[model samples]
Target: MPTHTDQVPETPRRRPPLGPEHRWVILGVGVAAQASFSAMFSGIPVTAITMRADYGLSTGELGLVLGCTALGVAASDIVWGLLTDRFGDRRILLTGLISTGALLVLMSLAVVPTGDGRPPMPLLAAGLLLAGVLGGSVNGSSGRAVMTWFREGQRGLAMSIRQTAIPVGGAVGVALLPWLAASHGFRPVYAVLAAFCLVTAVATWKWLHEPDDAPQGGGGTAGEPVRERSPLRSREVWRLALASALLSVPQMAVLTFAAIFLHDAEHAGAVAGPLVVLVGQLGGGAARVWSGRYTDRHGNRRGYFRTVGALSGVVIACAAGLTLAGAPVLLTASALAAGGVLANAWHGVAYTEIATMAGARRAGAALGLEGTTLFTVGFVVPLAIPVLLEQSSWSVVWAVAALAPLLGVPLAPGRRP
Candidate 1:
């Protein structure tokens, strides 16, 4: 055997003791970073109407541009995760945000439509794709920062709050981007998003950091933690990632097409359908925060994750049934939106468990895996909905969506997790 002194221990160097307020500040930076990215990620689609008009894009071209961002994100997630694992959260996040911002600024100058001319479609696609590849860094790296800063018991709450960035940034983006594109131009729209990214990058550089008190290998564990392996090799990580993807199908359906289904198919009042979609966004955000806190207090992350999926399956099935049976528009809209709240709520809990089980050391890769699958689902659901609509009815699409969460329930991790 090698001498004891020859066997150097590998661990994260101990951090200095941080003031409690600092952790919250770090969390805020994470939220801001994620929100800015989310604004660019999910918000791009909201400007679809103006984008199609400005770029003079056909239907197929519209879909291509819309999907490019997600495709780039999905393609780059694992690479960013690996880099986060190697370099740590601060470097990766700072680098990602700054580069992504610079890219968007460039796109605003070159790729967006001018008064008389639009850039080639492929050039626009490539720029958006690169923006996504860079922004993908935010998901895992910021998540890893939270994993390092927050204690195990508080991770659920922290991550849920971080997850809120999606709707928060999305709300801001959808509210502004369409109007900006319509009134000023696509250049202003892209420039504004770039401004958000650059602002968040400045804040992140200033305040975000590893706790001085944090142990290097990972945070949130005490005294001689269990040996960890690559997240790719862990069955538990795989299951959670897969389950996250499956559960996302229904949520994506509601998010992607709730308005169309309610307005076009059900013939609801114009405002009523979009109104329900807004309610779903608000309710889902509230539910995510509440569920995170509940699980953190009760120590029931796995149970909550699985139970929510099952309940969502039932709720979505009810909505599908109602749609098929020709239920009144009011009733169907209410059911679908309710189902959305539950479907969206599990994200924080599932992400918490995935990071916890994989150990904070490998949290980046595990969370990266989750991000990959979820974005892939987000990408695929929109494409699939059109085909499903062609094959059958809106009711049939709802039926397919209802099945997603139920299938996810069975893949919930082992009991101890």
Candidate 2:
């Protein structure tokens, strides 16, 4: 028998399992991973002018190229969700980040600069589409990881934090990409993005680990029976997906064209246009965090979601009217900030609700279904925005986009269907 000082120090008390600290670590990892993916896709619109001028792409062709990313994301979301549910979040996220980085690098290499210094449009579009397919892995896997790590009470806050990565990354990209494209060229922009992704992949491989207590192959609440049925069959799931899709139209509209609108319609300079987008992104990120905290404290995710949606509709409509009335640039920028914040605030709450409804085991599939619906609409909205701008005016486009969120107010979950 060992003496009092020789008993191996009682195994150092096993460190009591890390408690809340581990959850935050998980959150940080999720945010970084999601942001890496978002930067690549969200940065595209900020470079629209450069791409248009370089490649001689018309409005229609540019929209098509941007929409291709959404199409690829929609197509692959479900597949990635299935894989996440089957194998777990760590493996899925690692695979996605690594593969996506490699694909982006390949796209950079495939760029055949014409006399005008732009890659062939077809090749560029195809490259983006392929990158998007790999990037879809980020959403489902990161979401599932957060859900598994946090308790029910903390989920709204945690999910909101994860969701904030979208706008936060967009803010960074919108600020950086335009300047990079202006100074160095498009190829350097992509190279930097690829490097960011690869670095995130290595970090994830090193730091992200599956929770030991989490259920294997399924992610429901403790003792809850794992549901093998498709989450698509649930009415709540379908309604939530529809509402998310509808609300996303306005959000995507602003993201895809706000800079262009500022430059062309408002007669703002190149730097001024992206600056407005950057402001909107920052405001949207803060709104998401606040909304998440509020919903968590109040336990009213559905109600908060509906309220934000209705507010977004009003804001967008008002913004459109003001623009038509020749509002000052400052006023228009404020309107974009308001509209973007309200429009984006609901994503965290909406995603948390879907995961809770589906339970931990089926959270991946549920989230995937939501992604598919949202991105399918996202794919179409970009294509339509150009047509709307050409046939009508920016006023009409904003007014029409407003209707989507207003319709979503009644759709928010409450009483039985």
Candidate 3:
């Protein structure tokens, strides 16, 4: 269950998370809050042109700078998860969002290059890493909020909606931040990203609250009839977490390489590459919501994940084969789009299943563990892709990537009731 603070006297405790009466409002707040952070996490990469220019970073250095955020996220998720368990989701959300915004403001004032002098590469990289560490709170906190506030039938839908906020915020960031960076400067880009966090923080403060049934002092199992399953020790939890991480590998493969591969192979980076990205992100967002709602009614999240994993493997393998055979670019793009959507489609479903297995009380740690594993892979995939490409052909690299999702299919446990 979600909780706001310890020793709540009267005032803040009255507000809801806000229970069934205003749960949708809580969801809206969650989406907006998540989107704000997602924009920074996903959008910053798109500002590479201006960032590289201002910082005078080499291509390799730029990769490290970018990788730093993912590293921080991987490093801190479990810590945040543990904190979320001790505190509550709202407290963590408010603290994390506000601190994130504050750090960005600091970056605008101190870190970004000004008047022809550049900040140290280490400083810039460290700032991004710290931002990731602060912002990473959203994953477990927001998810735990859903697990507490919503019951099973709607939890899948709710979780997926929350999940889509990442891409929605990201798409907005990608669309806007690059232009802002080019036109105004990094100060304004930092300011705008900070604005997203601050604005969402306000929403979170006003709307996010403890559910009516939450434990008074804290959330985890204080008043329960039985002690909840601790996800940290559960074999099922580890298996599902591992499965989720494995499937994400193929999604990362498509996300990181589709554009570069298309550019090199078909010189279609101008149109087809972006088209594939747009298709994957947008379509993946829709597919996630749709699948979540579908499975909510069907009661088969594990089964759903298994099917999607197999299909993701098949579709991506086809895309790789088409590229290798020098087939029509349209067919390859279509295949990539399908593969990306399928690969991403199961995130909410898998997270819901994992959280469900762990129970609401332990949801934070379970989700945190899952995010840590996925992000660790996320950090590794981008770096590994280039190395694998240099050592082997594109066909070999993509063929290897396709196997990841297939390998993940068996890792999900049987459907939970």
Candidate 4:
């Protein structure tokens, strides 16, 4: 994948017609927002070990803990989208960062031992609910802010950069959290992430600003104020959502279980677990940026979606075979690296399509539905994987996983409905 600088057009160097200076402020704040949300998602890999020990949970239950966050994220995404349209982007973004950070700190505290050795389910559930509601808004709100700042052509690059925050933040957690858990325990991990979130929130509150005027071609009138479009009413919106949901099945399954498969199925080590997670996420992050540029060049994002989906199925099948055959560690790692690259590369392309089809006014709502559907499927599928593994084999699980992305084939060729 080309770096951000390499992807620029060779037409000519030019200045903006908007009569403004560089938008460095917007970019800086955008990175912070992405980082905060990244922290939220990234905490998963770090917390997995602590969660297993504290809750006395199995591998599937551990997957459920993270998956449950998706349920909240999916539910809140639409609500936040409606709120962003109604109240404006600044308010929504700030609320999301600050509130989500607070809830994360609370989640850390809730899981702390309370005199006795027993875990606190009610407190944790309440905290998780709050975290979900606020943390989930990070998805819709950040995109809304980006749409406000960037032009149509600029959006693919901008959102791809923003998407990098997910894995980058997760990578940070993966790199840090395990070591943190190994040495200091989970409370320190929570404290560190919460601190990062609060700092980003403060930065966002001080620096972030929405454009006073709306742009052209974004589902708004030239003179009239911007209005949020209803995603539920749009057929194209749901088709995009369906495609994304199916795409997520493999993506989520792989990420959720890759570490366990490496540790349990492959007998690698504590070291290999996070190494695979980091490698996959890093590859995924790069793929997102590259695919975004590719889609913009091609003009048919649905086509890119199907192609990546099909190829990802093949890559994952090879990884599954290696796992079944007990292939060498290097071979398994190679398959994982290749598969991870293909698996998550389509995210930005799919999202760019949503933002374009829905337009700015409706982009938040459309993405809200899209994220909800995708993560809702993500949350459910992994929870079932343990059951599937118990009854059948990983081969069956992989075969079923391979089939989910095929659902996109029909959607890709059809018209935007």
lDDT of each: 0.81, 0.83, 0.81, 0.71
Best by TM-score: 2
Every model: Cα RMSD to truth? 6.8, 4.6, 5.7, 10.0
**Superior by lDDT: candidate 1 or candidate 2:** 2
Q: Work out the TM-score per prediction.
A: 0.88, 0.92, 0.89, 0.87
Model 1 accuracy (lDDT, Cα): 0.81
Model 2, C-alpha of 396: deviation from truth (Å): 0.6
lDDT of 2 at 283: 83
The candidate that achieves the highest lDDT relative to the unseen native structure: 2
For model 2 the local lDDT of residue 287 reads: 86
Quote model 4's TM-score. Answer: 0.87
Better of 1 and 2 by TM-score: 2
**Reference-based lDDT, residue 321, model 2:** 88
C-alpha positional error of residue 146 in candidate 3 after TM-score superposition, expressed in Å: 1.2
Candidate 2, 132-233: lDDT as tens digits: 899899999999989888877889999999999988987878888878877767777788788978998887886676666766656544555567777878
Residue 374 in candidate 1 has what lDDT? 86
- TM-score computed on alpha carbons, candidate 3: 0.89
Query: Taking the tens digit of each residue's C-alpha lDDT, what string does model 3 give over 44-122?
Result: 7656656778899865576677667777888999889878977998999999999999999999999888896999999
Q: Given candidate 2, what's the lDDT at residue 288?
A: 86
Once fitted onto the true fold, the runs of candidate 1 whose alpha carbons sit more than 4 angstroms away are 1-17, 56-61, 114-120, 216-226, 260-274, 325-328
* TM-score result, candidate 2: 0.92
Question: What tens digits encode model 4's per-residue C-alpha lDDT throughout 1-417?
Answer: 889888967798643343223245665676677766666565564456566776567776676676776677777888987777666666888888887777668767757653566465555545555666777777777776776676766677777777777777777877887788777766777778788878988887776665545554342313434545576787877877887787677667666776676677778877776777778778888888887787667666777788888888787777778777878977876776677667777877777678767777777787788778876876687688888889987767666777777766666535445
